[model samples]
Target: MKGNDHLITAKAPGKLYIAGEYAVVETGYPSIIVALDQFVTVEISRSKSFGSIVSKQYREDSVFWRRQGDQMILDNRDNTFNYIISAIRLTEEYAQTLGRRMAVYDLRVNSDLDSPNGKKYGLGSSAAVTVATVKALCEFYQIPLTKSKLFKLSAIAHLDVQGNGSLGDVAASVYGGWIAYQSFDRNWLMAAHRQQSLTELVDQPWPNLTITQLTPPENLRLIIGWTGSPASTSHLVDKVAISKSRQHETYNQFLIDSKRCLNDLIDGFKNGSLSTIQAGIQKNREILKRLADFSKVQIETPTLKKMCDIAVAHSAAAKSSGAGGGDCGIVVIDKNQNIKSLIKRWEENGITRLSLRVHPVIDLAKETK
Candidate 1:
């Protein structure tokens, strides 16, 4: 193989959920996710020798990276960029283990998400950056990293940064389509007995269905409302774990119902059945209410709930996308509805609205330079 010395850049978009959140973390649940137009970009150029991966951002100053080895490195100065470095190191190691030469390149990353702009919309900026890094590295090294492998590797990097993370975000980033994910015991994370238990679950394949992207009717609209408060998703997940440990039946039931509702929503999406979608969204909201009361308590801020109420009043299906404690909400507008009027009302109430057109699953390999 000829070693090509060239610069390659790649971008990966952020995502939002149509259904399933907490349930997606538990086993036997399906979650639906769509890639948003917002994205993160990585620029990779050949270098004389491996030194450090330098990173720069709008809100932060230039930060130099650290080297771990020809395979791995650590950059603790910036928590946000550390995961990107970690993914690059791991990908390099994987390539070497297979008797391939790893590319030595310098990378520059930039994100256009609203997180740093004081908006802090929870749109998986971290996962998007990780996806971009992995894509860029694969291109530079000429490594054939499959989408599934990319999802698994990115999930590991996410856990490294957030302690524990659901695969939903990374799956959405790498696959660029709707996905349903559940946490099963992997040998890497499981103890002897737990590993055995996970084997039983792993024996059965995870059930996932990708939603078909539909052409939006002229009146259909998507409104993204910012709640004006930053959410700590990791903290909320930990809280749920603790609550489940106490054998809270109500919380457990919410998780179960969430799984069911998510499946229904997936079916609705696949069949283009809006009625089923509407019903599933309503059921999902009910389950979220129960979970919010039991597990997160203050998970939904007053402003967010009010926004949901407004959308419901307008015959729209709406809910908070992620570990909801005041982040962003997704509203599905009816084709016969007045989208402009709804946007006007939201803006008048200080909520930011964004228009998005859904498309088919993105081809991640095509994104490689």
Candidate 2:
């Protein structure tokens, strides 16, 4: 696909949160995210007339759009393609600034992040698809972009549609592997986007945003267990935001505690201390539980709790992964730990252990045309 200049293809890996779920939504808060093996792939090819967007995940539905000046007017009423449309609009806007000509193209997406039954696994598919769409469009338009520019463009597109998220998933998708991420100020970006050019915004430093790749301890093993339920990350984040507005002091403390916990977890990775890493996971779980209790939100469901308990019984540290209302739980244990018993227990309790590995970093330098 890289050698094919006529067709542009891009794959963005899904992500799972290791720590700092709710707190990471706030500006300047840090989180740890890992890019998963599963991905959402986007492929773009030139079209004769109007462009159509189709996805394998949504077999029956497709979106037809034609450019009117700079805006893409969707011909259909279905809103499932909003993220893709947003990505295209933003990417083309950036491309136009480079004096590139826009051409009609057919875009198709195939995702492996969901279950065969169309059940979402809470693996950040939306973010992955958005990043993939942006990357594909950039390539199709012959716009050279660094990984950072790609991330910013993708994040901007996602925020335009979703309006809420930490975009840690976007960072993980862009820079794959394990990453320690600090969220940028969306408020600042929104304001800047209105006043500044798209190219200028991508080139400028986004305040409070920082991404650093981290090398996990060689002995550390990551396990993901699904609760067979789907979670709405945006809805959960909105609920937490409302809760934060009501309980100012408590939310502030949570932000501080999450930062400290993430720092310790990153240090664990740096020092190769499996014990410290496990301890950090445990602490983060406790903090999330407390936040759930006070916010009156179900961050961790009963099934997730059972899964975590089962992992602990097997001497592993476990916690709910994303905006967990019951989707997936992550376990961090030493490589030497026997996980067979844990898997068996999870299976007995209706938890499905997912077979996924961390995706390695992508070389963005090669993306240049």
Candidate 3:
């Protein structure tokens, strides 16, 4: 664990999508993301074996990857390790652009975000792992990585495997903390991928993306409660897309309403207007319910509804966060209020309050040094 130039380690935090889940995937819409203290850590050192980069993770001790003519070839047979392999492939390709070869290193990934009994918390772990892996590999090869560069590389890797994500999670992992982000153009990126010339895209100016770091407004405390389950964000997003295709007017109205609510909330944060913030959160919750009614999807399950109702009874503004069918619900509470009673109430209702803090960093490159 002692310091050495040869041994490189990086940790990236998981994220919570505070607002703008499905809408932010569009080119100009904005989303709010906060990095959590829970993290994925990657540690790398020179490998004992030659001609192969070895990876070790939970239960799968030895998976090796090698390169042949710019293509990364895996020496194992498990889809469980695809994310790691994809990160390695993208890193190797990027290093080759800079006239350096990716080195063979023993890379190990571990996470501290799981529950005591090994259940996932839906805290953007994949994005954190991919970001950490990219950082570890780039450092091992001595290739300087800026925030923009890291985002591009991480997005490319993620896209290659997952196919479609807003990359808001990627942004959160690369640049930690509470941030307002606008999605980049996926079509342009897909074209770059088709050309197999990521170097050009990486070198090009970044899209007109805005990622601003902000502190929680005064006296505002964030309350995160888990429903003791996981919901597939992709599944929910795809379902919404299906609805959007058919219910164009409904989806459009929902967009306008959400955008208005988020703008007011963000402005309130800047101006220190707690009332405006609370109102915006409350209205957004109602809007979400209406969207569920329109789409006929269970966006807020009974458990989430109960959690939000509990928060409201405690004089807090609450809603199910992210693509919520079964996952966490976030409550915006006043710090001055006694939350002990509310916590007990939540527990009695089968809701588990989670301990999370924001991970703050502005520029990824500046922070790496």
Candidate 4:
């Protein structure tokens, strides 16, 4: 088999959910997410000797890996590299199905979402890395890349490692910009994985998954504030998923209200309904709080609550982003209101305001000449 000679590089941005996470995971409801400028980049070029995978932040330990038949055999026992490697293995396997042979190459992964001290920002690093690596490997093997195809491949790789995730982050990374995503059917995915027929999962368009592009009105003001803490989205989601099974009525009402709130907000984004948008944001926050109270999950931590309080004082609506044990909060100021006081109040309360905007996905593989 001829080795891939093209030096391909791909990058994907991290994501922050604006509304409805736990509910999305359970019933495959829609959630709004925005891709950030923070990204994970993977560069693939022909290797001289053997295949190696390296990371920018974790430079201390590098690993040598070989693809045999359909599996990736790595020398290192560290599971930290599983995210990227899982993507590598799946991409190679999928390429083989296209009658394309795999090649040995240097797959270098890098990211800027981490602190200098190696602390994470809870910006969906795993999903970003998985998406970027998958894209890099597919392009390296001369496999055609599409957003839908990329989403399916990336989701399989991520779920193979994490066991469970909503894949909202993966969708945001793949499509970029502001997106409303409905979860893929977990049962269908599990069945396919168990049967070792993941390719069967992507024979056509995803039946249960829905990702739509949406942009906020120009008059609305957006502010992102971080708590300087990384929250485990899976942990918080699991808590709600488990407890919600028993509390049927409460969870059902939450689902109904959550759907309505997001729909109203989406309508507001399409139109210039500032009051409707603000109302929906606050309504969603209250429903999430009620759900948290019933499920015994602290979806909104103390810091997030304080952030929301400050935003409220400034005549803005705020809510905890993502799963939210402790993480960033998104503030949507009605009209073109000033957030200087809101930002100042956040600083006074020790909250960090993160400057993040919608990052449209760029085709780096195509850009490489």
lDDT of 3 by residue, 8-92 (tens): 8888899887777677876767777888888888888876444343433365446766655556566777657667778888888
23 in model 3: Cα distance from truth in Å? 1.3
Task: Give the candidate number with the greatest lDDT.
Answer: 2
TM-score of candidate 3 to 2 decimals: 0.92
Clashing pairs in 1: 31-180, 68-73
lDDT of 2 by residue, 139-215 (tens): 88877878999999999999999999989999999999999999999999999999999989999999999999999
User: How do the predictions measure up, each by TM-score?
Assistant: 0.85, 0.97, 0.92, 0.94
Worst lDDT 10-window in candidate 1: 198-207
Cα lDDT tens digits for candidate 4, 209-317: 8998887777777788888787888787778878878999988999988888888878876787767778888888998999889999998889999999999888888
After superposition on all C-alphas, the RMSD of every candidate to the true structure, in Å, is: 4.2, 1.5, 2.5, 2.3
lDDT of 3: 0.80
For TM-score, candidate 1 versus 2, the one ahead is 2
Alpha carbon deviation, residue 263, candidate 2 (Å): 1.0
Candidate closer to the true structure by lDDT (higher is better), 1 or 3: 3
How many clashes in each structure? 2, 0, 0, 0
What value does the lDDT take at residue 327 in candidate 3? 80
Best by TM-score: 2
